[model samples]
Target: MKVMGFAGWSGSGKTTLVEQVISVLTARGYAVSLVKHAHHSFDIDHAGKDSWRHRQAGCREVMVSSGQRWSLTRELRGAPEATLDELLDKLGPCDVVLVEGFKRAEIPKIEVHRAVVTEPLLFPEDGRIVAVATDTEVSTTLPTLDINDPEAVADFVVGYLAL
Candidate 1:
């Protein structure tokens, strides 16, 4: 599957843009998947839930299944964090995968930016950035996409990857 990433600082609207782009792509009948990197510890199961209880009881991995859907939660248990490639391998076949972080990963990416964030742009130091999606004007040789226009961003992604 083709892969693209969106990288930016906190409050740069990366999440919002990614969500909107997903909607556009899916509406066009593309099977899209996303892998987001969280900087902090996170939990998908809540206490008192069966899955949470299984995890609390020291299960190495707990999978909850139902008619609608299912999810598997694995406990690293001090194991090293999984790399981006490893995580990508676990996903099923899809037309595209939009990664939400892993800024340093050597994959094509769109650097989402917002002028109000006051942070320096990442494209200068990252060669994998093929474009920039921003709310305000910016200086760069790469293609600049209107952050508010998800359709345009979706078009860029499809055209860039020739999906």
Candidate 2:
């Protein structure tokens, strides 16, 4: 499977662009999977839920299944977080994997930038950044894409990966 990433500071519209790109790619008949890296502690299970209770009871992992969908949640239990490669190995087969973070990863990535954010651009230091998607013009030799146009971004990804 092919892999690509979107890296940006918070509120830079990375998630929104990724979400729209997923819709575009899937609509084009490609199976797409995503791996999002959360900087803070987060939980998919809610308090008092059966699955949550299972985790609270020290279960290493819990699987929740329903007619519509199923999910497996594993507690790291203080172990180091898994790396991008390890997480990729856990995903089912897909045409492409759209990663939401892991900015330092060496994989090909698109730097999402918003002029309003005070944070400096990442492409300057990140050799992995293949292009930039921004709401405003920026000074860069890399290909600049309109952040609001996910279709264009999707096209760029397809061409870049030759998928």
Candidate 3:
């Protein structure tokens, strides 16, 4: 599978661009998977739920199933957070994987930048950034795409990776 990523500072509209990219790419018959990195602790299970109870009861991992869908939750239990490659192994086959974080990872990615923001561009420090999507006009030599237009970004991505 082709692994691509979107990297940016907080509040840079990375999610918005990523969502549109997913919509556009999937509509064109590409099987896309995503891995999003969160900055803080998060919980998908609610208190008093069966899955929650299982974890609280000292279960290392819990698998819940129903007619609609099945999910597996595993507790790290002091184990360090998994690396990008380790997390990617858990996913099934796909044509592309869109990673929202892990900007430091060694993968080709697009740096999303907002016009009003003052944060510096990440491409200068990262060689893996093949292109950039920005809300304003940038003079960098790297290929630039409009952050507001996902179609153009998708087209650029497809051409860049020959997907």
Candidate 4:
């Protein structure tokens, strides 16, 4: 499956832009999946939930399912964090996989940027950042996309991927 990523600093609205692109891509009949890298610990299950209870009881993996949908939560315990390629391997296959982080990964990516953020632009230092999506104007030789315009961004990605 083709893979792309949205790399940016905190508060740069990477998540929001990814969401929009997902909507646009899916609407166009593409089977898209996303893998987001969180810098901090996160929780998908809450207290009193069966999945949470199973996890609390030390289950290695807790899969909760119903007629509507299901989720499989695996506890890494003390295992080393999986690499980006390893995570991608677990996704089976699809038209595209929108990765929301892993800025250093050697995959093509769109750098979501907000000039207001203090961090410098990533494309300069990261060769994988082949495109830039931003709200304000920025000068760059690479293709520039409208971070606020999902359709335009989607169009660029689709065209780039020739999908």
Candidate 5:
């Protein structure tokens, strides 16, 4: 699969741009998958749900299936956080994998930036950053696209990956 990442500081619109790109990409007949990394703890199951109950009862992994879809939640517990490659191994094949966060990983990435974020550009320090999607005008050798132009960004990503 072609792997691309979206990296930026908090409130920089990475998630929004990724969501838009996914919609455009999917509409264009490409199968896309997303993998997001969260710094803080998060929950995908509610307290009263069977999956939640199974997890609370000390099940290492719980797979909940229905006719349309299924989700597998695994508890890492004290185990070290899994690497990007390890996480990707668990995902089924797709034409592209749009990863959010995992900024330190050595993969091609599009940095979503906003002037209001007031943060230094990740591309300056990270050679893996291939392009940027921003709200403000930027002058750089790499392509700079409008953050709202999801179709343009999606086109760039697809072209870059030759997908």
Candidate 6:
């Protein structure tokens, strides 16, 4: 599957841009999937739900399935965190995969930048970054795009991946 990534500092609007891109890409008939990296603890299961109870009861992995959809939740149980490649392998087949975070991974990425964040650019230090989406002007050799224009950015990604 073709994979692309969005990387930026916290509060840089990476998630917003990615959401917009997904909408546009899906409307254009491409099957797309997303993988996001969370820095803190997160839970998709609620405390009283059956799946949650199963997990709390010491199940290493819990899979909840229905006719329309299914979800799988697994506890690492002291194992090392799974790598990007390992996570990607779990995703269903799609025309493209849009990843958020994983800035260190060896994949083509668009650096989302906001001036208020005042963070350093990732493209300068990371060769995997193929483009930049910024709210303000950025000086770089790579292609620079307006962060608000999700369509253009999505186009760039689709073209880059040749989807």
Q: Residue-wise lDDT of candidate 2 within 69-93, one digit each (tens)? A: 9999999999999999999999999
| lDDT (Cα atoms) of all candidates against the true structure | 0.96, 0.96, 0.91, 0.92, 0.94, 0.94
Q: Count the backbone clashes (under 3 Å) in each candidate.
A: 0, 0, 0, 0, 0, 0
Cα lDDT tens digits, model 6, 1-163, are 9999999999999999999999999999999999999998788989999999999999999999999999999988799899999999999999999999998999999999999997788888999999999989899989999999999999999899999
What are the per-residue Cα lDDT tens digits for candidate 1 across 1-163?
7999999999999999999999999999999999999999899999899899999999999998999998989999999999999999999999999999999988999999998998899999999999999998888999999999999999999999999
The per-residue C-alpha lDDT of model 1 at residue 60 equals 96
User: Which pairs of residues clash in candidate 6, taking residues 3 or more apart in a chain or in different chains?
Assistant: none
Model 5 alpha-carbon miss at residue 44, Å: 0.3
The lDDT of model 4 is 0.92
Q: Tens-digit lDDT track for model 5 on 57-92?
A: 999999999999999998998899999999998889
Q: Please tell me which predicted candidate would have the highest lDDT against the true structure.
A: 2
Better of 5 and 6 by lDDT: 6
Candidate 4 TM-score, true structure as reference: 0.96
Candidate 2: the clashing residue pairs are: none
Model 4: worst 10 consecutive residues (lDDT sum): 84-93
What lDDT score goes with residue 149 in model 1? 99
Question: Considering TM-score, where higher is better, how would the candidates rank from best to worst?
Answer: 2, 1, 6, 5, 4, 3
RMSD of 3: 1.3
> Model 4, 32-100: lDDT tens per residue?
999999999888999998889999999999988899988888899999999998899888679999999
* Per-model TM-score versus the true fold: 0.98, 0.98, 0.94, 0.96, 0.97, 0.97
Candidate 3 per-residue C-alpha lDDT over 15-68 given as tens digits, one digit per residue, 9 for 90 to 100 = 999999999999999999999988887777999998999999999999999999
State, as a TM-score between 0 and 1, how close model 3 is to the true structure: 0.94
Q: Model 2: what TM-score? A: 0.98
**Clash pairs (backbone) in predicted model 3:** none
lDDT score at residue 93, model 4, on the 0-100 scale:
74
